[model samples]
Target: MAAPLAKEQILDTAEEVLRRFGLEKASVVDVARALGVSHGTLYRHFPSKSALREAVGERWLKRVSIPLAEIVKESGSSMEKLQKWFQTLIHTKRSKAIEDPELFSMYNALAEESVEGITAHINELIQQLTEIIEEGIRKNEFKRSDAGQVAAGIFYGTARFHHPALAKEWTSPNIDEEFRLVWNLLLSGLKF
Candidate 1:
């Protein structure tokens, strides 16, 4: 007999199901069947389909956030750190969009439906940026008086690169050059 599925195993299988069938068609039953169990078994791990989708979205964002968090912790001039952080976000988003457009589409849909998880993830990202900006301010490298506001502006200003709605634009031939221009402009504004 198949062993009872662990929650992490269920989430992993759910991700594959979502990837294979897409979020709209994937369901708790599908996940259970993939795991050789019943929908009731899956429910014990995720109370509802929405909860499962939220977990999937949370997992996707974690994959992106971990590296960014590491970059945030590295000791470097704020200018260097900020540049790398922005570039990392752009690169990560663009890579996901290009490498797995289908999965990216599923995530975009899930992000819309799983508001709470995505919202918290975004808030955490903004807070991370705020910390980096605060570091810069303390070092007298940036002129921003409000790190939170500055971080939000930075996130929004670079929305073209990271925003899922604008994913298609990341394929532009001059995207790198365009990002470089935007990065330079942002740095110029932030410099003391």
Candidate 2:
């Protein structure tokens, strides 16, 4: 009987296979070879290459989400949290699961999967920001009427303006500068 593959072991093998061969060429067979496992054994755990790919992506997202949640929780201000959230998005935008924006989009299109956990994560931020905006409206810190839309607009709109592609290979120096610049442009009118 073959011993079960550990989750980390499986992911490591999958990552090596993907990185070496590219996502298109990397197959369950490749991962099995990398892990010294039989196809049947690997299939017992992952069913197919796509399933493994999704599992790997899910694990990676969980890794990033934990820290982003921490940053949002620890940030002192809603606006500060928003900036931190943008930083987190930019970082996530450059992960292995999304090596190329076009490739990632194609994967999304094929899988019909929505990165909605991310949208949910941003929703949490929006709720937090809504409260802040509400407080600001009362105290004249911000304008009122549609804090939720405004929050969504700031988030998605900024995300649209600074598409992950624009970040270019993750270390693009434009990320922070772009965030601050966009925030400044939006904040003036947004402020009370």
Q: Pick the candidate with the highest TM-score.
A: 1
Model 2 lDDT, residue 169, Cα: 36
Q: Rate the local accuracy (lDDT) of all candidates.
A: 0.86, 0.64
TM-score of 1: 0.94
Error of 2 at 80 (Å): 1.9
TM-score of each: 0.94, 0.67
| RMSD in Å for model 1 | 1.5
lDDT of 1: 0.86
Best by lDDT: 1
Alpha carbon deviation, residue 117, candidate 1 (Å): 1.8
The sequence of per-residue lDDT tens digits that candidate 2 reaches over residues 55-160 is: 7665554654566666645635655665666667566656633466554543333233336544555566566656555555665667676878877777666765
Q: What is the lDDT of residue 55 in candidate 1?
A: 83
lDDT of 1 by residue, 145-170 (tens): 89999999998898888888999999
lDDT of 2 at 38: 85
